[model samples]
Target: MSTPDRTANAPPLDQPAFARLPRDTGGPVFAEPWQAQAFAMAVRLSAAGWFTWQEWAQALGEQLRLAAARGEPDDGSHYYEHWLAALEQLVLAKGLSNREMLRERKEQWAEAYRLTPHGQPVELSAAMHGDHAHARVLGN
Candidate 1:
């Protein structure tokens, strides 16, 4: 198997703020599949009337500025981290999901990722079956 082309999922560079995205000739480049997923989520959400493109741009720009202020190197290595943070913040502000729910879902994904065999797509159900989640909580 080969790595998927994450760039194919990249958001269109319509927003001027998107100029900050790391890109290649094929368009925006994502370091990971989840990064592309997050990008697409924001685009879809905005398109669905959850927010306007301008609001998304402002939130993303503010996230990048906050990261820079916290002394993150401007090497583009953590762009998706900031992207996810901005998305979470916006989602909270929009009342789409609360912090506790987000935390639980994140834990679910983390556990699934941990238990998954290499090269297999992780499944959330894998995190909850039998004693997998319980054992991880007990640090076993």
Candidate 2:
């Protein structure tokens, strides 16, 4: 899917909470496709009125702070991990999904990953049922 315009509704690039985001001259950079997907999910969710930008900044800041407190490496590799964590928390807090459901879906993805052959796309089993509306948004 096309990314929303950076010059449009995106938060300011200079925000303190975003200081550690991996970026280059053009803008934010992602080491993997999933990273950009996560970033876009956050931007879309916020714009959709799920949360305000300040709340997003605070949630992301808290995730980064917690990661630092736990002594995770400061390298940019984990930035999107923190972003994903923050997104999960925000979605849960907003009552979009419950903890049990989220846990199960995560486990499903883990299982699917383990069951897939190398370099092949991972797919959840046919028996799996998920909230496709939200799952699609989060790239689950």
Which candidate number would show the highest TM-score if scored against the true structure?
1
lDDT of 2 by residue, 1-140 (tens): 99876777665443345346564566547778999999999999999999999999999989987877786755666889999999999999999999989887777777667657889877776224464433432444
Q: Residue 96 of candidate 1: its Cα lDDT? A: 98
Writing each residue's lDDT as its tens digit, candidate 1 over 1-140 gives 89988887865443344246564566558767999999999999999999999999899989988876686665677888988999999999999999988887778778878888999988888777675554553342
TM-score per model over all chains: 0.68, 0.63
What ranges in model 1 sit over 4 Å off? 1-28, 117-120, 130-140
Q: How many pairs of residues collide in model 1?
A: 0
Cα TM-score of candidate 1? 0.68
